[model samples]
Target: MKGIILTSHGTYASGLYQTVKMIAGDFPNIKIVEFHEGDNLENFDQKLIEAYNDLTYKDIVVITDLAGGTPFNRSVMSLADKGNVAFLSGANFAMVYQALSSEIEDLSEFVADVLEKGKSSITKFDMEEDDEESLEDGI
Candidate 1:
């Protein structure tokens, strides 16, 4: 089995999780750890450890908001020894949605697809660059 762990500097993790739940409903395999203001690194690390321990999946993926931020750094340092776990930073709705919705078996393939879809979802809609005559035309 595979699972997802979402951690961020503040409520971003929980907020994003809630948004995903609204669209995709609840998924039992997903866990969220939030690092709020005034929270110490030790506490946050402990909470992350608990979250990881709670998951029964053999393979886990930890997603964080920023690459060099506390959440990401802590996860890497703490879980680096875990062979079946992977880490991804700068997570967005598209990445999480693809992760929770997909039924893929291979962890590498799953992560690759999530990265591809997530990156592709980011687009700039410039009227001038896109050669759109008017905003109303796009609508």
Candidate 2:
């Protein structure tokens, strides 16, 4: 089956790690991992490669915090030589939760679904806003 890994700049506190969990809660199929030190642009690739190997998925999606950062750039580059994984940078709770909730398919389709859900889940207005005002608030 497919799986997900959420990578962030490692924290000494597990409290920080617990903050970004997949919305569906923890399951074997979807898990999160962290890389603490030596996670900067200079050595992200090596660190990511190590983490990737430790994961249990054949088909995997890695979600990182920011694009152009060490983690994101390294993940993208690693994907160029590998054929079984999808790497998405600039990850948020929305994206990670979306990925964790679904079943596996083609990696490309999976990536698109993640992006779509992440984009759609963002409501410009508050959930408690008046319905009448929301309609004219410009979609």
Model 1 regions more than 4 Å off: 127-139
Tell me each candidate's TM-score: 0.87, 0.68
Model 1 clash pairs?
A: none
Candidate 2 per-residue lDDT over residues 1-139, each given as its tens digit? 4676566656411232354442245556654545566545545566556666766776888787776755566677765476778777766656666777777567788889898887777767665765776577652
The weakest ten consecutive residues by lDDT in model 2 span 11-20
Off by over 4 Å in 2: 10-23, 30-44, 126-139
The clash number for model 2 is: 0
Specify the highest-TM-score model's number. Answer: 1
User: How accurate locally, in lDDT, is each candidate?
Assistant: 0.87, 0.64
Question: Which residue pairs overlap in candidate 2's backbone?
Answer: none
